[model samples]
Target: MATFLFDKIIFGPVKSRRLGVSLGINLLPNDCKLCSFNCIYCECGWNPDQYDQKINFHPKAQVKESLFEKLSQMKANNEDLDVITFAGNGEPTLHPEFSEIIDYTIQVRNKVFPQARIAVLSNSSMIHKKSIFKALNKIDDNILKLDGGTEETIINLNQPVGKFNLDNMVKLLSKFDSNLIIQTLFIRGEYEGKIIDNTTNAELEAWISHLQKIKPKEVMIYTISRDTPSDNLEKISMNELEQIAKRVDAAGFKTQISS
Candidate 1:
């Protein structure tokens, strides 16, 4: 399977399944992926060996300049932008000046496209950081990932690189107090000889329990819709996704399915 990366600081106002016409901001390196989690289903492919590669994150000044230029041009052309998303080759919050960047993005959005919402599509790894947590709270759409329920499922599926604690992450998510949106990618396949499936009845039970605790405003349920680094993964169908969404809805939370 062939995967791709966004090779620019400001990439697209691409038609997203979840987000409408979204203008993306890539604060990570334009060349390689730099993320806390190395999920097998990542469209940017697996995390590369960074032992020798120099990771150059885009500076806050550069991001501000590029975003202002792009947003100004789009406004001038009368473009339609529903949201300004912080999503790129990797985790957008990993940037050194993530909090400052979010502040700047909000300022820019207010100046150019006040109607457009600001979103950060994070994996929820950096939520423990006070600055990152504060920044995420400030965004219009604080969409974070919770791909699985149990620690084993998360470790097998998301493959967090360094220190990771699923319980702690869930606790941090609960801190949002319904201000955030939980995005779960339901996947079932064999990865590295382990049968990976998060859509099972038991899995759903546990996941819903976590959602109950987290109490996000909405739960965005979907599956793999792009070329993944691993070839053994399977995309959950719309029917299956609907079934999952129903469970989430039954648990007393709003659900959005993007099959």
Candidate 2:
């Protein structure tokens, strides 16, 4: 189960299944993964030993300069840019100057590519912080993760590094109401002798119930499309994803699937 990391602060304008041509921004360190959740399915691989690791986040000024330079070049060449996304090595919200960076990114995006939207692909672990939550709301696409309905499934799947409360997280998500887009990665497999599956009937029931409470603008349902850190994981099929999407649609939320 080999995985990789984004080696640059400002990386691709890669074709995304869910989003159009997206120019990515990596706020975390370039050398290693730094995140609150050490997800088994993370493409950037597992979190490193932080105790002995010298963690250094990309500075806000550097990020702004790199982004402006890239966007300026892309705009000059008339490159198709749909979104300026905050997604890379790890969780972008984990950066200390995340809010200020967002403000700068917004300014740059408006100046260079007004048509392009700003989006953040967050795991929803840091939304409890007022600054992070406010910054997320300011973006065009405030996508957040809600992988599991139950606390047990979330803990087993996400493996948050610190304290986690499913009830409180869902409640906080509800604050965004229609402004938020809930993203859920559905998978079934065994990890550390435990069977992990969020596609089960009971699992979907609980997940949909949470969606009903949150009332998000849209729901992004996806499965593993790349090599994961864990070898035993199984990717859910498109048909299965559609079935799950139907459940979400039935619950009265817009659904987007990327298989």
Candidate 3:
């Protein structure tokens, strides 16, 4: 498997294809991947073997302290920043003190890079919680994933390990009322013995219908860009991505294709 875990509380002011010059903040454990969904195309590999022992997550004060130091140092060095993104080993919203961390991050970010946007890349599994929903609503870019419109496709692609279902996710996403950004990943290949493709006509029509229902502020369409846990999956070409974007745009939703 092609594993790419970020073993740190704070990492990278790396170039993001969509977010641009982003600084990452990971709220999960630094030593392993902890997520609600085991996405087939995740660059972070499968969840760690020591999942039950993952109780040593960083404390909120420590996260705040580290973020403050890093942001202050970056500001001192005059490094340009476009966004402070919450993305790392796994789902950031899973943190017990996630709301507190976000509040602290916004304070520190405002002190250092007042113009920088606070963005979170989430799987949209926890939005059902009122607290998670409120915290996400405070950010500048609330980017949530909607990989598949149907339950079977979601299970095959995202592989939610809990009671999460596509029907509830769609309903939760629609609650944003066009205030959020809808991110969709298109892929086709095989994982295990089954054929995996969310780009089929049936899938696309269903996905587009959900997009219409959600009525997001923007629709981000893209495909695989890195080595995935499932090696057989292939990246959809830029041309194909553009074709999908065109269709989304025609539906009266603003679209962006990150190739």
> Could you estimate the TM-score for every candidate?
0.98, 0.98, 0.97
Model 2, 1-259: lDDT tens per residue? Answer: 8899898998888998999999999998888888899998999999986534456898888998899999999999999999989989888998999999999989888888999999999999899899999999999999999999899999999999999999999899999967999999999998899999998999999999999899999999999999999999999999999999998999898999999
Q: How many backbone clashes does candidate 2 have?
A: 0
- For every model shown, the clashing-pair count is 0, 0, 0
lDDT of 3 by residue, 46-125 (tens): 87655674377789988988899899899889999999999998899999889888888888778889999999999998
What global local distance difference test value does model 3 have? 0.88
What 10-residue stretch in candidate 1 is worst by lDDT?
A: 46-55
| Model 2 lDDT-worst window of ten | 47-56
Return the TM-score for candidate 1, rounded to 2 decimals.
0.98
TM-score of 3: 0.97
Worst lDDT run of 10 residues, candidate 3, spans 48-57
How well is each residue in 1-259 modelled by candidate 1, as lDDT tens digits?
9999899999888999999999999998877888999999999998887634456999889999999999999999999999999999999988999999999999989999999999999999999999999999999999999998788999999999997888898999999988999999999898989999998888889899999899999999998988999999998999988888888888999999997
Candidate 3 stretches greater than 4 Å from native: none
Pairs of colliding residues, candidate 2: none
Count backbone overlaps in model 3. 0
- After superposition on all CA atoms, how large is the RMSD of candidate 1? 0.9
Q: Which pairs of residues collide in candidate 1?
A: none
